[model samples]
Target: MCTAPGSRAFLEVGGRHYRRCEHCHCTFVRPDQRPSAEAELAEYRRHHNDAQDPGYRRHLAQLATPLLQRLPPAQSGLDYGCGPGPALAGMLREAGHAVALYDPFFQPDAGALAQRYDFITCTEVAEHFHHPADEFLRLNRLLRPGGWLGLMTRFQTDDARFAQWHYRRDPTHVVFYREATLRWLAEHHGWACEIPAPNVALMYKPVL
Candidate 1:
């Protein structure tokens, strides 16, 4: 959805036009310009997604560190969009939590989606959502009461800066979210939201 209410084209990246939702300040590439499934999968495969990669582990720790602290012993979680390596699942498993993995491309375990979780993580994945509102609502439904949803996408700061942002270069990165957009999500879904670190957010489902 275009951000400006009137829904005007905002920017053209590599000849692909994008739209911003002014009300929510969310930006997204037009549907017709989106990459094919094969291309997107190929792009993902290019990433160094090895779980044993020390640098990758450190980057995931940005979310895992805080999440591990909040989870009690033996809680179960799901690493939604865990990608090829699923290092975050490995990390949480090491912390004494039972973790299930789901990735549409690499680990498309349908049974994982059938299960609910005490907490769920979607690091560096939310931006790839083609239908963010629906996907987010689905994620919320997957949680148990008082469950956590940790995310690690870079937030869009402003329009002027968006044109030059490095994160937008990825063709699969469709939707962009702002801090205010996230806060609106919290208010809309009745989840308590917190941003403990840069490009990271923790949303808590109500205990009820």
Candidate 2:
């Protein structure tokens, strides 16, 4: 099995090998089994992404649309993993919420984490996290009470299609979350979660 330091090895369902962290229970595709960082970066660069891409504009609106409905008129947010261009951030700003952009590869602002937000978004990004359990908790901690977390990623739909699901073909996609898995996560982390669409979810912090 492919095991990284501090990450435990788990079962391989189909051709994918898994590593389960004892502390996190995140069944991840082990590092040695994954594509090289350079290869992954090259693949990411292949995305026809630009701030001016109109299709990209409407795509970002999917997250902004739900987030706008949930948040107050002028709430602040952070678009975590905003990719090479902060389209989601721009969309949120247009919706009237101030948004800060942070991407590990692009913006890389450490200071952004210091500021809490009314909501946080991780569009098409969570499955790429190296430490999802920790990161998911961090996303939780970053939100103020009654705040929301909007995530856009394809849900693990069916075991029958596990081999053929187009989303799984992405080399950078390491973790796959089922609806029940997200539910368990929501309950585990003390948030109210819902998969409003097949590809999106909204998690609201518990109001005390």
Candidate 3:
């Protein structure tokens, strides 16, 4: 009953019950098992996410490199779910792209959500989606024609490894995506999808 019928497949990982979607191949924590909003926000606040961190910049560069290559100069972008530090937005700005920041707990700039962008970056953020389908639609609507959406998250490989996957151990990370799941999302929204790097995907919305 998550997102739609035929989307939830139940399983037990380390005695924790999880659900996998046949439609999109996204694994998810059960609603009751999810952490409280305050707890989730507190965890986010604990992240260093420092703009000056070389290692963190390199991690963001994984998505930024490809996305920058595809975009023309002076393009505007939104760093969706840009947590407390919002280093990604600063990186994009440093490259001369006009960037906006939005995070439910951090930036909380609702007006940013009301605007469209030439591209949107959701790096390391998709798994936090409570309503993946709805959030996807919102991102789609936020993009200008022929815009792109860049995402970076670990893709679910298979059932066996999923049991021991370190990414799943995070309480805030609920929905999980497979490569096929990203493809399905692209097809669902009539966008072009490409994997420019490992654990990174770029989805392009066609111009009218």
Candidate 4:
């Protein structure tokens, strides 16, 4: 029995299978078969998303567009999983939000976790999580009440084409989540969720 990082759902991949957890329903990749943190980091570095292209920015904006309008000026934010260049953090700062940058590989600063924030962004980072439950719970712990957690990732769809999907072609991607999964997460975590885009979601923890 393997508990997925976020949910307790049973998972079977590459001939490896795991029992589901009743509490979280997270489907996890087995330890022996799962990718290691070191192997995962090496593959993340191979992403060439730093190129400042209008098209690329627009592609990224697909994730940030709705957020640009929703986030208030000067609200604190964390650009979680900002790859080597920290582009999303720069964009949030340019938009006048006080943004802090952190990445397990690029900007792993001990102090980044010291304070809470009003918002957080994780673009193209969820799929690489080795233990999403622990990782996502950390994000939850870091977020202040009413803070927003934005994520950019392709939602899993049940289709024969997924195997051939370019997004999954990268060896780095391991975990898969669907739109319902995001919804499930928000409900379970007490956050209001919005999926304005197919690849983006905004979850807000209510100030109770």
Candidate 5:
């Protein structure tokens, strides 16, 4: 998000207040309502993500297939925010790419952050960001020029469905992005963005 001051109250769901950023149109939960590190880690650990799971692989393919199609052979990539099971990293590795994993709770490797990558995959991770501005800045710094930054997260389309939306119900999901929000991010960061699949966005950094 654009870090602009003064966001209007967007919604109130289950005692948590949501605010809309005037600059980026991105919606985020109030800081006071956000889950603590311990609570967030506990919620994440409850997920059963297996690298070998076929269904999970297929779900991840929504982002991976498009990204794989665009990547050059044997490129170096980073699976940013890869959870307890880095299935997406394994998928990328199977396609002959060198992949590094980084997750604050599960695989916190500072060395990985020091290096740049040809591509970065952030699947279902952006929503958990407490400070999206800083997170996106880190992602931009981690990618080489002309590199790809692929993301997968459910888009907030209809306000009517927001109250009952399953994606926002998760305590860990604090931020929500719309198509416009993604486009704003691309323009602000000097990247070309495209939506190749539902809930999937592919952004390419310009070669300087």
Candidate 6:
């Protein structure tokens, strides 16, 4: 999100309030409506996303497969916000890449954030941001110039189906981005952006 001033009331679904950013077209839940950290952690713990599960691996492959194709050999990467099971990190590691894991709840390593990487994978992580602007700035700083940032999140498209959208139903999912929102982010940060696969975005930081 651009974090520009004005935003209008967007929707009220299941007693939660959402607002639409005028600058970036992002839909985000009102701050007061967001779940507490403890509640969010509890909700995340309920997920059974195993790294060894074939189906789970396949699900992650949507972002990994495309990202792998674009990466050079032996690149060092960070799997930012990797949930309890970091399946994507393992997949990237298997492909001859060095990947570090970092999750606030599961693997909180401050040292990992201190190092810069060649690429960063943020799978299904953006929507959970409480302050996307700050989080993205951190992501950009953690990447070396010309580094890649791969993201995978269910995009918000149909306003008509928003109420019935399964992605929005998740309590932890507080923000939603459209293709336009992603483009705005790329433009704001001076990165080249591409949609290599559905629900996936590949952003390349410019080399200074």
After superposition, the stretches of candidate 3 with alpha carbons farther than 4 Å from their true spots are none
Alpha-carbon local distance difference test for all models: 0.87, 0.78, 0.88, 0.75, 0.95, 0.94
Order the numbered candidates by lDDT, best leading: 5, 6, 3, 1, 2, 4
Model 1: lDDT of residue 9: 85
Q: Write the per-residue lDDT of candidate 5 for residues 56-167, one digit (tens) a residue.
A: 9999999999999999999999999999999999999999999999999989999999999999999999999999999999999999998999999999999888889999
Q: Could you say which candidate leads in lDDT?
A: 5
Query: Is candidate 1 or 3 superior in lDDT?
Result: 3
Q: Number of clashing pairs, model 2?
A: 0
Clashing pairs in 6: none
- Model 1 agreement with the true structure over 1-208: per-residue lDDT tens digits: 2223465588986787998777877888887888889999999989848899899999999999998888888999999998988899999998899999998898889999898999999999999988788888889889999899999999888788777788998889998888988887887789999998988889999987
* Tens digits of lDDT, candidate 4, 1-208: 1243344435454565433344443334455666677877777767667646567677778777888778777899888888787777777777888888888888898799888989989988887787776888899999999788999988867545554567765566666677777788888788999998888999999999
Model 3 lDDT, residue 150, Cα: 97
Clash pairs, candidate 1, are: 2-20, 2-21, 3-20, 3-21, 3-22, 4-22
Candidate 2: the clashing residue pairs are none
Off by over 4 Å in 5: none
Better of 3 and 4 by lDDT: 3
Model 6 root-mean-square deviation: 0.7
Model 3 Cα lDDT, one tens digit per residue, 43-124: 8877657888999999999999999999999999999999878888888999999999998888889999999999999988
Residue-level error in angstroms, candidate 5, position 36: 0.3
Candidate 3, overall lDDT? 0.88
